[model samples]
Target: MRCDQVRQTLEESGEAYPAPVLHHLRHCPECAAYEHHWRWVRAGLLALARETAPEPSLGFARRLIRRLEEGFLPMRLVGEFFETAGRRVVYFTLLLATVLLLAIALPSSGPLRGRPARDVSWPQPEIVATRDYPIPPSELPGAGFSLTSESDVSGGQK
Candidate 1:
């Protein structure tokens, strides 16, 4: 059998080595070394399991519980609230202040506000009395046009 198969069998069988695994370990020095390492690990683990764990001092559990309870004071609850919701409140306040600052810093005559009334007056056209062309006033470009009836422009058609 292959070294991997033999090692897998040895691991699965725990302390019991099958005939094939024993034969493989006897021939393969690499597998024998692997088995030796695992034996040492198992022995150490068994020794740990057999040894007794150290006991805590008297009132250790009570002291730990008392300390845990003391940690949950009203001030601690307030601190937890500040840790969570306080950040959001501060951010919202900062955002509102920023918006207010922008509103105050911006010009009052922005597009949102109505345009200011301009005190500008258009220049009146001056009439020239030059004798260059003696054209009649009735023959002016816009003189023939008036607010006439629509029927007059439509050839009197109804």
Candidate 2:
């Protein structure tokens, strides 16, 4: 069997796999050799002491902690949120415009309460009725109509 096939079986629990996999490993020379080396390396790592430590350069931990603390302030977080949200606000404004257009295009069955509603003129008199000011066909001396008194024209009628 190939090392890939054997490595997969080694990674999974034996109870989750078929028994023939283990039997094949025992008979396959290459798989048996790979499994033997893998077990030896795993044992070496497990046998190490728990207290083993790696040495650190001077001020490395303190400088890393300082960098993390300086970069994660609340103001920086709020600024980043606005930067990410600005595009969404533009899209929301576009959606609101579309909604307004549709609202105007569709008619409603209520009082015209919306702004810029249609303006209707009041029911004014169409046919003016004035009597006794007789109309004349010709400006004759003795006529069907005549002015009783001469009135000045400037601001005169009122």
In model 2, the runs with Cα more than 4 Å from the true position are: 1-3, 12-18, 49-51, 54-158
Root mean square deviation (Cα) for candidate 1: 15.4
| Each prediction's whole-model lDDT (CA) | 0.77, 0.65
Segments in model 1 whose C-alpha atoms lie over 4 Å from true places? 72-158
Q: Which candidate leads the pack in lDDT?
A: 1
State each candidate's clash count. Answer: 0, 0
TM-score of 1: 0.40
Q: Give the alpha carbon lDDT tens digit for every residue of 102-155 in model 1.
A: 889878775666665552444433344343544344433476665545446465
Residue-level error in angstroms, candidate 2, position 75: 28
Any residue pairs clashing in model 2, and if so which?
Answer: none
Instruction: Write one digit per residue (lDDT tens) for candidate 2, span 1-158.
Output: 45587677775543344566687777888777877787777667667755568889899899878978888556778898898899899999999999999789776733455544344544433322232343233433456555533443222444
Candidate 1: what lDDT?
0.77
